[model samples]
Target chain A: AQTVTQSQPEMSVQEAETVTLSCTYDTSENNYYLFWYKQPPSRQMILVIRQEAYKQQNATENRFSVNFQKAAKSFSLKISDSQLGDTAMYFCAFMSGTSYGKLTFGQGTILTVHP
Target chain B: EPEVTQTPSHQVTQMGQEVILRCVPISNHLYFYWYRQILGQKVEFLVSFYNNEISEKSEIFDDQFSVERPDGSNFTLKIRSTKLEDSAMYFCASSADRGRATEAFFGQGTRLTVV
Candidate 1:
């Protein structure tokens, strides 16, 4: 069984600054994918960024990027030029390449972007 | 962009009553899934459906929980006898395929409240 862990229960960042949410997972599989999802007050879960475990280069999507360290089993999400809209509960997820796309998510971290 | 749609954004029901949550996945998607998140807990996988049958399921998906693709467009999750612990936000997601890189698109969750 794969388990994702988000150590930080809560985090805050000033507007226009940057914030990084840490995530770690335990999986024996060599091929997998990691993702960061944002859940706003509306209860809509949105994809922030994703990283393939086989890729050495990190994945970047506009202001959202991931620091993926496969050896350390760590995949952290970084949000640059953070805005108030970034405030939400962020969850880290893991999906094995052979598991047929089933996702295992972390407990989540409450992030607040203060103006 | 294609998106998944769920009906009855919010549902309130008495304990022991039956509740059905409905979702319409993307037109071209081939995989469907159901997940639930308690108010302060991680998003837990319930079941995954493919080819009109269940391909995978978690421990949380007990005998009380059942899924059906009754028609061409609708995917439904039914809780035969709801309990207080069953109150949570239920999410419906779909992926284009079971390939290694496909992303699952999620719908705005349906909040279920069992009192």
Candidate 2:
């Protein structure tokens, strides 16, 4: 069983600033995938960033990037030049490469971007 | 751009009543998944389907819960007898394949309110 944990319950960042959301997971499998998802007030789950376990290079999507530490089992998401639209609930998810595409998600972190 | 779509953005139903949530995944995708979040809490994996059968399911998915693909495009989740705890936002997702850690696209969730 894989378990993902997001210790931060809430986070806030000023507009045009940066914020990093923490995430960690406990898994026995060596091959897996990590992801960060954002859910705004509209209630749609949007993909933020994703990192493959085997890839040491972190994944970046425009303003969203990730710091994936495989040995430490830490995958954190960093949002640069945060905008008001970035205000949402962020979740960390884990998926084993050997199994079906079953994603185990952490308790979400509520992020607010203020001006 | 193809997207996974779910119907009935919100539904209210009485306890002990059956509720069917419908979703249409991307036409080219082969893997389907169901997840739920309880009132802004963690998103929990419910079940994963492939090749017209269930590949894996979480412990949270009990005997009362069942999934089926009645047609080529429609995937459905059926809850035989809903409980108050069943109230949550249900998400439908799809991926191109399994084992590669491919990204899964999620649909706008359907909020299910059990009274």
Candidate 3:
């Protein structure tokens, strides 16, 4: 079974600054996918970024990027030029490469972007 | 962009009552899934459906829970008897394919409250 861990329960970042949320996972499967999801107070879960385990390069989407270290089993999310809209609960997820696309998620970190 | 849509943004039910959460996945998606997140907790996988049958399920999906694709476009998660612990935000998700490279798009989620 795969397990995702987000050590930080709460985080805060000043507006226009950068923030990094840490994530780690334990999975025996060699082929897998890592994802970062954001849930605002509105309760919508949105995909932030995703990284393929086989890819050496990290994934970047707008101001969101991931530092995917396959060897260390670490996938961290970085938000640059953070804005107030970036305040949300962030979750890290793991999925195997098989036919079943079920995701294993971390406890989540509540982020607050202060103005 | 195509996205998944879920009905009954919020549902309140009594204990032992039956409830069904509905979702309309992307038109081209081949894989569908149900996940739940208790307040202030991680998102947990419930079940995954493919080809109108359950392809995978987690321990949390017990006999009380079942999933069905009753029609061409609608996917449903049914809880035979709701419990207080069943109170959570249920999210429906779909992926274009079954590969790890493909990302799953999630719905806004339906908040279920069992009283």
What lDDT would each prediction earn against the true structure? Answer: 0.93, 0.92, 0.91
Tens digits of lDDT, candidate 3, A1-115: 8899999999999999999999999999998999898989875678888888888999999999989888899999999999999999999989898748888999999999999
Docking quality category of candidate 3 according to DockQ thresholds: medium
lDDT of 3: 0.91
Docking class of 2: medium
* Candidate that beats the other on DockQ, 2 or 3, i.e. the better one: 2
Ranking by DockQ: 2, 3, 1
Error of 2 at B104 (Å): 0.9
Clashes of each: 0, 0, 0
Q: Write the per-residue lDDT of candidate 2 for residues A1-115, one digit (tens) a residue.
A: 8999999999999999999999999999988999898989776687788888999999999999998999999999999999999999998999898878888999999999999
Worst 10-residue lDDT window, candidate 2 chain A: A41-50
| Pairs in steric clash, model 3 | none
Q: Compared with the real two-chain complex, what DockQ does model 1 have? A: 0.69
Candidate 2: which pairs clash? none
Stronger candidate by TM-score (1 vs 2): 1
Candidate 1: tens digits of C-alpha lDDT, residues A1-115: 9999999999999999999999999999999989899989776688888888889999999999989988899999999999999999999999998887899999999999999
Which stretches of candidate 2 lie above 4 Å from their native place? none
C-alpha RMSD in Å of predicted model 2 compared with the true structure: 1.3
